[model samples]
Target: MKKTIAGIEIPDGVMAQAATAQIRGTESELIFHHSLRAFLFGALIGYRESLTFDAELLYVAAMFHNVGLNVKYHRSPYRFEVDSANAARDFLRRHVVIDRLIDEVWTAIALHTTPGIPEHMSPLVALISAGVQMDVRGARYDDFTAQQCDEIVQAYPRESGFKRKIIEAYARGMEHRPETTFGTVNADVLDRWDPNYRRLNFCGLVLGSDWPN
Candidate 1:
């Protein structure tokens, strides 16, 4: 959607990218796509949820968060976010995104990895980081692994603060499970395969509808 945030007129290309990342199904694609969604949702939620500046920064960070997924997948799977961060730095520099915003985006992306980093200096970064961690760990209150439950308890040792509540909410939201299997019917995703239904269109998330302007 062509929504303006922080006075910057964001284009649909960014939103399309977000959608593309969302419907991605590959193991590699799944994580990066979730990262993008988390960022977008985090960004919008940041404003809609708490009117926080950090959330806005996180939203921006999420847009470019996984730009390096392809590169990292071809290189080192574990380094996806790191490579994506470097790519983001370069892209932000060229695109004239302010240095502080670049730093915040980079921080959010870097801290989103499993066993996440928590050195974010802003509330937005902290919030996004916490949300991402919750998603990676487990979103369901009853679904937490022993280790995950321990992590949750440690992450929110106190059960009565704004941060704790926000984190809990994020965890709850990330609990949704999407259908990831490839359909044998008339699927048009980029990765669709059909020897019988060879008339099917291209694979991957289809960008058929007109994006928001």
Candidate 2:
């Protein structure tokens, strides 16, 4: 059964997939709820803005966007975004999804954490990032109506202490592969959780490099 949230229809087929089940099974309840909220908030934004996008693609992208935080992918050497992107790609391939659509979903997951760039990409890519920002940082929280927010949250409650849990999950995921966190927001998690963790300074790197004048 499909459901409409904020005037956006979430197809049943997308939600009933085995891959989607894997996400629900593997990710913490907090992360799973956050993912659903991201999609709902994204759809709400798209509806309000009248942005044309593939709803199913956005749904899948949002669902798997944080799968890298799951323990199964903790050891992955790449950034969590890349890991999640790969997982989504693999899942779509299993369903014999077309290459063009798979590429869009992959880009959406891969670049969801990236700033500025995704806004210039396809609607799916842009919407995933927007949804993530809304849920994670409340980037555009004020733009959403109180009633809309209430309904969305009521459907998928953000349990108490969600902020701390999400931060810890991010820290643990990056701690397993700290190197990947060097240049991203994941670094902030490491900085907060691991005092000894030092972020790479691009300016310092450039200055320290040998140069001939």
Winning model by TM-score:
2
Top candidate by lDDT: 2
TM-score of each: 0.44, 0.93
Residue pairs with backbone atoms closer than 3 Å in model 2 (clashes): none
Give Cα-based local distance difference scores for all models.
0.45, 0.84
lDDT of 2 by residue, 81-154 (tens): 99999989998898889999999999989889887899898888888999989998898999998988887888
Which 10 residues in a row give candidate 2 its minimum summed lDDT? Answer: 7-16
Candidate 1 C-alpha error for residue 12, in Å? 5.3
lDDT of 1 by residue, 141-171 (tens): 3533465344333432423453444333322
How does candidate 1 fare on TM-score? Answer: 0.44
The window of 10 residues in a row where model 1 has the poorest summed lDDT is 177-186
Off by over 4 Å in 1: 1-32, 44-51, 54-56, 71-73, 76-78, 114-120, 139-213
